[model samples]
Target: MTIFQVTLKNCAFYAHHGVFEQEKALGQRFFVDVVMDVEAGDALGSDDIEQTVHYGLVYELVEKIMTGSRRNLIETLANDVALGLTAWSPMIRRVEVAIRKPSAPIAGILDYVEVRVEHRN
Candidate 1:
């Protein structure tokens, strides 16, 4: 299967995503990463926007997730986003999304909290 990749790296969003009540009440910044796999052959020759996944639409999809309501877990959010993106585009055979929280409420020091999800159609 030929593959085409679309990656949106280090996207920041202000949203409530935590289990604790205070955490939900006070929203924090979260990062998102998205990648998509598409059949490249069809668009390889023509170089037609119509034949491939439009990058603008991908951005819109991600924006929607960022602006949407609070979620308890990034895993669920990532999975839903990946599945939703693939479902919207016929050319996409699979999609992968990663959501990261840098300032998680953890006592221990860490760079970030992240979850990755993959979907295949």
Candidate 2:
């Protein structure tokens, strides 16, 4: 079986997702990266859109999940994205999701806090 991957990186959104009340009240920017492993049996030869995973639809789904509800942990958000993407298509064998919180509520100087989740179907 031939496998292909579709990756969406650094998809940005602003949402309320944190453990603290202040963090919830004041939303911060989040970045999401998704990688979907797909079976490309005929897609490579046929070059048909329907044969392969549609990234536009994937982006929409990711956006919906990112902007949908508030979660206390980015891990939960990442897991949700992984599960959601794996269920979106039967051709998808695995999904990897990463959520990054750049403005995490920390005292010291840091770049970001990120969580990564992977799901297999």
Candidate 3:
């Protein structure tokens, strides 16, 4: 089948998500990326809003997951987000999600921690 891709990358949000007490209390920024594959025919041919995925709504869903609560693992969060998107629309066949934590508490200085997950329904 033909695939239409939608990617929301480097989405930043402030939330309490970490393993440390201080990290949870202070709260920091998290980044999320969502890639969705959907049926391409109708959206590509008609160019109608109804025929395609609404990216804004996708972003809103991601934002809700990001700022909603304190989850210890990006993997769990990513999975939730990916599954959520797939559940949102029947046209969507697969979803890939990446959650990045830049301010994670680590032993030494580092760039960031991230998790990528893919889901199909």
Give per-model TM-scores.
0.91, 0.96, 0.93
Q: For candidate 3, give the lDDT of residue 89.
A: 86
lDDT of 3 by residue, 98-118 (tens): 998888777788899889999
The lDDT per prediction is 0.84, 0.92, 0.86
Report how far residue 67 has shifted in candidate 3, in Å.
0.7
Ranking by lDDT: 2, 3, 1
What is the Cα root-mean-square deviation between model 1 and the actual structure?
1.4
Candidate 2 — which residues are off by over 4 angstroms?
Answer: none
Question: Residue 38 lDDT in model 2?
Answer: 94
- Any idea what lDDT model 3 has? 0.86
Q: Write the per-residue lDDT of candidate 1 for residues 12-70, one digit (tens) a residue.
A: 88888788887799888888888888878678789898888998888888878766867
Error of 3 at 43 (Å): 1.3
By lDDT, who's the top model here? 2
Q: Best by TM-score, which number?
A: 2
| Candidate 2 clash figure, as a count | 0
Task: Identify the superior model by lDDT, candidate 1 or candidate 2.
Answer: 2
Candidate 1 clashing pairs?
Answer: none
